[model samples]
Target: MRWKHPVLGEFSNETLIHMAEQNGLIFEVGHFVLHQALKAANDWLAVCPTFCIAINVSSVQLKNSGFVEQIRDLLALYRFPAHQLELEITESGLIVDEPTASDILNRLHILGVTLSLDDFGTGYASFQYLKKFPFDGIKIDKSFMEQIEHSESDQEIVRSMLHVAKKLNLNVVVEGIESTQQEQFILEQGCDVGQGFLYGKPMPSEVFTLKLESHAQA
Candidate 1:
């Protein structure tokens, strides 16, 4: 989310999201984000059956009693495929109300929506989260990639993470993959998916759609 500030111009919503959390407004904000994301994906990628859209989910939104139903209703309303919509939840987000979060996640899984544990390895109880939650995959945090080329410890850490994820049968996606060396290293480590500046920076929806169309034609 981005905010248009009168003094600071446009900025990302990190501060705004903190405020929303403090004010008990994150639930509404989270739902709005999900709704808009699903709507946009449905509108732009309706014909692209292989495309999957991932949305970050918050703890406050997860604990809400109606969260799962909201997702179901939205998918039906948009006529979007449940399996093509991935909800990325952070370890910190799942820390609060574990039982509730687990229940909600289970329900979402039942609906055929993919669930990914986002920013893996940064949180305090990352391993515990893996044991508790029913996650289909994990996105390794970018911190591990920063010094992966030179640091043996970082390399071991990533290898360990990949090993654990593999043992759990979870798909692993490495983040912050900029240089070819970094990409090659993760690829060698058996990470099949990655996202970073190396591939492409963030772009508008129209530009993304055009790229997809071009790729389809190619």
Candidate 2:
């Protein structure tokens, strides 16, 4: 949050953090949000059938000594189904320390919560990390989507990524698709899921709830 009340108003998390005088509260807030993830998943899935939620855990969080137990406790406390939750961890987060990463990743897998390797292509030791960890899926970096249609090389890259996913049996969710053409092309490339402005821009929870209610009614 901003140190001083914004004269213009800060309406988003990014802006709130940007206006902050220091990074002191970010981790605190993030720590809180980790719990909120459980609450949201428990509350939402209670009312809606066949739904899942994804939460990103930072590298710092992953390496925390109690991270897996914290999740285990949260699941027990909230009675949240581990299968209904997916924790997306970045490549850098996992590769920083192998033994620690290996231990926690295994614990997470044993807990039955799905793991996704976030930002698939932009980090170090991508292939090696994938092989070492039991990740359930991959989130293709948006950089490739920057020119998916215009660049044959981009399309080829996308295809190659899809091929890797297939061989590894890891689902692919391509990001940054912003047009009908891009969406169609990504589907043709065998991406399992797509996210970008073409689907919907990020919005406040109130707006999302209204849309969700509308869909439920429909």
Leading candidate by lDDT: 1
What C-alpha lDDT do the candidate models reach, one value each?
A: 0.87, 0.77
lDDT of 2 by residue, 79-177 (tens): 888877888888767766778988998999999988989888887677778889889999998999898778999888888878988999997888888
Question: How much RMSD separates candidate 2 from the native structure?
Answer: 3.2
Estimate the overall C-alpha local distance difference test score of candidate 2: 0.77
Following a full C-alpha superposition, what root-mean-square deviation does model 1 have from the true structure?
1.7
Extract clashing residue pairs from model 2. Answer: none
Cα lDDT for residue 88, candidate 2: 86
